[model samples]
Target: MDEEQDPSGIAPLLMAIAQQDQQSFEQLYRLTSAKLFGICKRMLVQSSDAEDVLQEVYLTVWAKASQFDAQRGKPDTWLTTIARSKCIDRLRLGGVDRHTDLIDLDQLPEPEKIDPVEFASDKQRLDNCLSNLQNQHRTVIRTAFLDGCTYHDLAARTGVPLGTMKSWIRRGLMSLKACLEK
Candidate 1:
């Protein structure tokens, strides 16, 4: 199995990292860096900026390893949150003009077509699972994940507390996972 999917392995690595173990830190980086880098690249347009932010993310992870609570969430989720926050921070600081970097849809190459039969089957399963979620959960999950709204932004827009927003999303995701696994 891929180590990236093994949360059990990561929990121990995080524990060792909390104690300032360099080898464990490197191992953790190897297991998760590609995923985190993709998150950085998605949020920040420039590859150089993404690389810089990714380094900063690892630094933050190293410093804040003790703050991680395995009982509260998965290691990848914690890592992803840190990476995403760092990217947002870089954007907020005006390192890049996000609006100026927008792609012209007309100039983009056409995407490859896929088999509609397979696509519709997977999409139908996802839609069915999403429909099983609570109304608030469904809305929050779609807005947060699909629309790329941050939890803080979602909370503010909906007039709910940040922790409550997070709980709703977490519960929604857990329900979706269980439903999809069937």
Candidate 2:
């Protein structure tokens, strides 16, 4: 079993958290916050939003830690699940108002048209950079960005764990950034 699934370690910490032990809560936060934050950051796409989601995750943990059952899953998995849910909730709430304010296209200034040759060159370069990524990375990045899928949607479509899906997108973005920079 992976360290995450090892109940002997995490179970005790969680039990302590359930009992409202501040030190144990601190220890739990110290152990799992980075991984949880990474999940939030990947799903939310804004560091400030991710930070808010992370805080909400901990608050939920504080209230619901007593309900966590070790037999059901690992502590890390439990924590990450909460983080993912919080991030998705925030995403949905934020997206609700996104289309409410409409700018009239007729009233707006005209966009500058790009030169076709330059556009083609940029597109080709981007395609080349994307092609450099691993198949999994490329697929996740494209599905998430190009196709406008959320992390939740991508995980459901791919049948992968939400955390794994987030990792794929995050690593894919980093690889793309490096390749594009070169």
Candidate 3:
């Protein structure tokens, strides 16, 4: 069990929130916001964007508190599911994959971002797992996926042949795929 929970999980907090209890919502945010923000920022890759999603996640939390089943999982786990689902929804809507690296971040029109749920564990298992990879492999994976950098970007940054960078990303992602599944 998460040590951070109130005596009865977040159930009491949820009821407070559902009843528009500002104080409980503040307490809940204090208790869980950091973990949730970490997940969203890692996936969304931008602080402002992650904050947008965080707001959405909280809105869902307030609206759907009754749906959370503590018997099925921890309160944190239910919160994370909502965060993750919301992130996936943004991805599905093509908001996440928008051409940022191509256009300068400042020049692009800001899109309305939903509560960002990123593909991350509620815990840091993903980081612990990723750390096991070689530094170069990690760089490739982060550049290709998280940073949304291009193969050209990788090649340019590392001074590797473009083809080589492509091959490395392909193989590296395959390794990541295997590791992620396990």
C-alpha TM-score for every candidate = 0.58, 0.53, 0.50
* TM-score, prediction 2: 0.53
lDDT of 3 by residue, 1-182 (tens): 34343333576787678788889988998888897887677667667877888999999988887776655667776887777676656655665633233322224332223332432352345565556665666666665454445677667767778898788777767776677778
TM-score of decoy 1: 0.58
Worst 10 residues of 3 by lDDT: 103-112
lDDT (10s digit) by residue, model 1, range 1-182: 23433433787888899999999999999988997898787777678988999999999989999998877866767888999888878876875634233223234332234335434565677778887888778777765552256777678767778899899999999999999999
Predict model 3's lDDT versus the native: 0.66
Residue range 56-147, candidate 2, lDDT tens digits: 99999988899999888767668878887777677677652111222232343322343344345555667788778877777767655422
Error at 56, model 3, angstroms: 0.4
Best-fitting candidate, measured by lDDT? 1
Q: Which candidate is the best by TM-score?
A: 1
lDDT of each: 0.75, 0.71, 0.66
Give the candidates in order of TM-score, highest first. Answer: 1, 2, 3
Off by over 4 Å in 3: 1-9, 97-182
Model 2 misplacement above 4 A: 1-4, 95-182
